[model samples]
Target: MSKKGKKPADSPATERPRPIASTVAPPPARSAPVTSASSPPTAPPKPTQAAPPDALIWFDKRVKITLGVFVGIFLLFVLFKWHYISLPAWNEILPDGGPAKRGLVAGTPKRIRMDDYAVGAPWILSNANTGFKTENEAVGGLKTPLLTLPVKHPIIIFKIGYWGFMFLDVERGYSWMYNSSPLILLLGTFLFFLLVSKNQYWLSLTGALTLFLSSGTVRWSFIPSSMIGYCGLAFVGAVYLLRSTNPKVYIPVAFGLIWIIVSFAITLYPPYQIPMAYLFIFLLIGYVLNERKLVFPPKSVLVKLISLAGALLVAGFVAYLFKSDVDETVKAVSGTVYPGKRSETGGTGFIANWYSEYYSWFFDDQQFPKGWLNICELSHYLNFVPVVSPLAIALFAFTRRIDWMLVGAMAFVVLMWLWMEVGYPEAIAKATLMSMVPTRRGQIPMGVGGIVLLFLYLAALRNVSLSDLKQAIPVWFTPVAIVGIVAFVVYTAYVNINDAEGMLRTDQTFMPVLFFILMNGLLLFSLNIRYRMALFCGGIILFLLPNLKANPLSKGLTPLTENLVYQNVKTLVDKDPDARWIVNGSQFVTYMVTATGAKQITGVKYIPNRKQIFSVLDPTMKRDSAYNRYAHVTFQTYINGAQGDTTILAQQYEDGYVIAGDPCSPKFKKLNVKYMLYDHAPQIPYEVRCMKKAVELGSMTIYERID
Candidate 1:
């Protein structure tokens, strides 16, 4: 039936619609059958074949599964068994014959990392024997907990190393956790860049390796490295959960976030943690804003926000479970004279140090300038982002396109620089929460931000072609930018050279030229999309080469674990687990004793026990200046025995102190000293009433208190 104002097909009133006329007249119809007999008929064009499917497409499920299987096998069978730990530094202290007999598989162990070898690694092993309790009796007794843990603490109850304990026995668990710290950093950094760059493979990889091999990371591989890694994981998991739409992924991502957050917090190194926290907050805000539509869609925004809040709440709850322990720790640490109550007004850092990475390769602990800086503190990442940032800003201005991530990273870096190189008012520092971060520690986040800015700058230029750049940027800008970058590089080098004051070697003088060339090349390559990945690859090589030796590739912990001295000490401690001992002559021996699970009064003290421990040594509190702070305790024989003093204490440095006293003194007995390990024979005659030689092994002797 016909509808209103419409006609049916059979309606007589329906007229045939005429085609719309063309504006130009059509050509006259060709005459029919005009082809000559000799002319061959044109063959119908062959049907076009579909273009071959892209061979370099992203990995499919099958390929991904195969690769995952291989990675798992490699991790379980190979990586976990070997370690890059600097435990071989013991070879120097205990000299195992010669180079051939040394326990190291390859690379020279850094003696400069005595903290890792002498304190951190030993305490980790000691915890295994103590049922993984937070209070390690080996060092500062129940008052000072082991700040560095490879296993779950009884009170803390959570550590990233719990996975190692779940899979391996105590010894192997220590090895696994030690080896995996760097892996965590590498993987987390890789994942962070991958997510931020939208899965730009080479760029992500370069960023990850650059940070992994960075001097600060390798130098402080235990706590700071793990902290950075966990922070990265937390950021990555947060981003994933925020952008996720699947309910199935929500629970897993939330759980991962909790783990990451807790692990990061427990690292407990505020100097690194505070700065990194500031950097991540900026990045997270910028990321959410940049991906607002995807991260906070109208349909799922509430659910995502609730999931994030829930994850954070659960993490906070877990931390609250150990509130008493956390509070006690925080109180003790905050009360310390060295780090506790320490506030910085900034403007203490040297601008030359930013460029010091170039000369840092030649840093010899022995040859390092006196009272200038230590090796660990001198370490920094080689970052040219600050030098190249002006050009990036100009490009962004000319193109009228701003990458919020780049802006966020740049802003963080600028803030850190201002705090480190420019003094701020105390009120401003407190308001900005920069008081907790020292000028040296600010380098951690600043270096990290610089690298992030560098990669983000490259990512921002990904879609901008060279032709587009030529059109968008002025003719004079290129030469001006080039001159500016060179000037910056030269000025930076000049400052560093003058600050170094002839410390740089003859060959190291070319580092600035190389840096300048690389910076110019990076700028040039970034302008063209084709060379972007190439530039990243070059960067990876540049980062990996010099920093490869930052850490040594050592095999097992046999140097300490299997040595006769450790065996003897372990056997002795096993017999009298409650007896408190002392190590005389060397601090390294004290660390060895701590590792043997023996209670030692003279070892690394995480938290000073002023009331019980220090009071016994200094009853009158006259030596509070020496023993009040956290210190690595070392003992030297009292040369002036005629004075009849039981003990004489002096602060050797901020983190160390020396006590010169007779081992048989009444003060040592009051501290519950049962035995003493001496690196040399006692210069004073052993008092039969108080002490006697227990045994002699090689050049070392152990004295047993016989009160």
Candidate 2:
């Protein structure tokens, strides 16, 4: 293939699993003597690949370790989610009964439309002709969807015991599917470990478990982050397929690439399609440069062009099915206030004006590219997913020779850095112009970078060249690696000190830091487990025990949360036929609908009508205008001009009542929200003010619509 100017990858031999029989020849024999005009070249016999007795032992041990790790992980999750020990069914924040009222499990347009309030109802519940419906620009003509199947249901279903759940699988919780990606990402880690490591099974499982349950993976699992997950899924396939020295590997890799592209249509980040395309180009270019194999193989650029074009065609066809209004989609997505202020200034009044213009994009020395931007402005940008500072991590490749995972990792680094490059202050104008979040939304690259570092470190540790370590006699590098691991852990811990507050604030931040600490700690300790299992286990697990309890699913929760759960009970019922009323003291919406035979909106989304709401529960603020009450709500934005209609929308007795926070912040005064419908506010500001307790239904408090 090389003699023909063909890429090594394009060679028919590059994609399949290499034969490993002892009698089989080594896949590459590039050292064969070249035939010249002056001399006859003797054909050297093929190099054998017979497995040594020790190789079988190594393989078996690796598999054993992998199984043990997998089982341990599964058990940990199962134990935490053993049974929902949550508090009694009380009112949930932004109480609403959406899709359940519409006879569905939530995530439907009926639910999302009301909850998100950012899009038109029709566009959200597209049930019309063709595939999915979408628009390229805010007001562009309707276009086809990008995915092959209607992306309406891009989740998976798992029947774990009696609890059947849908994830990324639209059939279940629509917007709640972040767990699926971790599983796929684990496969990539496993295959990578398979590529390195003397105790292959132990190495593969260790990396796989880390990737699978990585803090970032779990924290991001709740939202609609399937794009990252799907990409990860594809990355696994691509790495394995490309690394093989046989043809079978290429076929799947090609298909995997197509699948990766196809999945992008369903994401909020539509423009990312361009970068993803570039990623494919990146892979092809790498293969061509390294192995001198044309990335698309069949000896011609035409085939590659056709294949790529076909993928684009499929995407276009998918795009056509959308009938949604472009304005709605773009507004729903691009309307964030970066630095805490609107990117565009216009319209509205007073609080609305203030809200639309309040600024928070302050430049922090820590965030700046060397802390250059010190501007204070209100703009729409995104908070980055917490990951290690990518710059410090990129030093790996310069420090060592590269392999398959290493290459994929390098690509990941580029993409993640590209994400930061695309956003940050340096590229604000360009990113805002595109209506995309700062490059942080593309955190898959960060994840890939992590995987790369893990692999590089492990590869260095587990290399067979260190015969002393492989044979268990220990090597010179072992002590150095140990010291290196210790320093890395301590330095990372120091980096975390600055971030500890953020980590403490949310499970999202805490998990990543804790995992980094533990992973390094484990890697360090695992190498010398004989004398310190108790010490290492105690140190790491003790810190983890407190944090693990924070997961709502974990056992032995605090009684305060338990008692609160027992205090609130809300329900739906057709009781007292004349009223056919829906009443609740519980948190569950489904119970409300099932108990009361009335229509109720399920879930929460911003609505412009908040200013007109009249509260019936609170006596102290009954006369306050909805507009007056609304402005006091700290977390919300004014939907209409502060000058717009301040008149109360619903009379105290007519329309259904809404359940919300108390009169603590000026928000209640701004909106003139007439209701004080609770005994307590457990969340933030609302909790500050006391209210009359309704009824303790199973642990949740039920408030009343006061007069």
Candidate 3:
């Protein structure tokens, strides 16, 4: 034993104090036996300090100014090109009359109405009373809801106009929102990057451009739900990534972002947003592990949990507001339509061929008769960028330097896509949440994941060394997998005889070749990482350019409001303000007439009545056909051609258009078809038919019906 007064080397005075909670007391000192010729006292450990904020790395002053200038220029350019600044008359905004083609309508001068007309028609035409109204068969009405339900997604196009263009008149507001939706995407990307990157202007700019220029974005640019859904996903990612050493700053921001996430989630379109939701969830988990070791210090945990609870409550309330409508829409869309079931004899289910044609993005001259009419929404449109970023992610994973949360998020998306394609059992798909989203929409999440991983890969590379590269390179399985991808693509192409039969377009043959080149570029970079980023950047730019220019930016000046037929129809509606009408020959004509303050028996809507609205126009259509299943007016034309159907042939209605049949009919009088608008004088079965020629405006002929 040591002398009574002598203290031990490992005694309290010589020992390091453990970090303690404020409520806990320190232990009382204790004496210990002395050791031989003494070792030096050990030093106390330094208290841990959080790392400097990572978001600061991107906040360069010059980058902000440059991005601002570029954005201002872009906005000004679009404004001038689209004639939005000076403002055209509402009548000149969008064309109303044009010739119809098979599988095409002349809504706009060019046949670009897949979005400009089809989805946007209701908004531009202001079909306020178009949804499920009373069952009035006198006007060719039905007992069932005319619309599917929860009209929010379809009406979002109109809402954008209603809210965003408050400065302009009603018609122009819709026209503006329809044409300038790309700006919304750009704005969302900027806000997202600003929050996540801490105003890292360059990164924000790149990401915004990447997302905005993506083929899916370009294809869905006119559809507000698509862009709005993307904005929600971006908001989620931004909020998830926010963190700071200072709790005061980050904690409040975190709470606020949580609320934002809840709002965004409630507004989500399952097709695009579900995958992104899962992706951000993984990213959030990863961020926690990387930054906080999955343990937010006790105080932080309490605040985050409270915030989450509050957000969920708010989201629940919001969802309840539209829950009924959404449920009905879900049921209707899942029925026998393009993306729906087929006949019992087993023709291809409406959207099954489109799903099978997923590989069009890989082919140069690929065609998708049933896919997004814009031709840019194919999964592979981003070319090698999607393929290569995942490789980089895998490389980092192999070396154990990867942030697995990010990896897990991306891996889940790939798995979900595969799950859908291979026809896994529903139990498995549902368990994995793959069945919740449409198979076609998987591209959106995969595209987002690819971009996120690209940013992650770049960040990882910044601190990596040659030794790290050496360590990561030996993971030969990644390269082997890439080879396997190439082989599978070639074998599939050969087996399908896509080469000789030209079933697959050969125009884009360079894409698969480009994938190899990108892979080679990555290999080249392992030797030296400093300069090859430009090559990859160039490759990305090349992939983006085609889709970016899919529609003319200058066309924004030429609105969809203008047309010879709209003016004529408006005049007719002005004469008899109380009557409802129907148009024959063209859906665009119907939309134009609707825009002129007329009620339509049918027009373009996201979910048209499924219980055979076409049967109202042609009684024979009560029997099921493509028209009833598709619930589109254009399907009537096809059915008319296919079956030589004369049920509607020569049938005359007062809204405008007389078939070769008898004009004086009790059905026409009961329907209150006051005026018939047609391209030519129709054959009157008898002179006693109380139909008088009203006016002839060029190719359009108006006939007033007096029973």
**Model 2 bad stretches (over 4 Å):** 1-179, 188-201, 220-228, 236-256, 269-290, 293-315, 323-327, 335-448, 460-603, 606-707
**Which run of 10 residues does model 1 get worst, by summed lDDT?**
17-26
lDDT of 2 by residue, 338-454 (tens): 112223211111111111101111122123222112111111111111222221232222223333433544565554454444433434434543233334333333443445444
How many clashes does each candidate structure show, in the order listed? 0, 104, 24
TM-score of each: 0.84, 0.46, 0.67
lDDT of 1 by residue, 1-707 (tens): 11233222212122222111101122234444555789987655433222111111123343345336534743763344555667788877876354533457667788877777778777876776666666775655344554556435443445655566556775466666676676677667766775666445566667777777777677665446666667778887777566555666656777778777777777766778888887888888887777665555434566766776787777777666566555766677777777678677999985347877756655655556543467677766777775557766776676676666667888888888888889689998887777878887778778877877777766555435566557677667666666766666666667666777677644566765565556555664224445555765685567457766666766656778777778888888888888888888788788888888777778888766666567788778898777666788888877455678568889999988888787678777787788888888767574424777777778888878888
In order of lDDT, best first, we have 1, 3, 2
Ranking of all predicted structures according to TM-score, beginning with the best and ending with the worst:
1, 3, 2
Candidate scoring better on TM-score of 1 and 3: 1
Candidate 1 local lDDT, residue 54? 16
**Stretches > 4 Å off in candidate 1:** 1-80, 96-101, 141-143, 151-157, 296-298, 305-314, 359-372, 505-515, 525-532, 610-612, 618-622, 636-648, 660-662, 666-671, 686-688
Which is better, 1 or 2, measured by TM-score? 1
| Superior by TM-score: candidate 2 or candidate 3 | 3
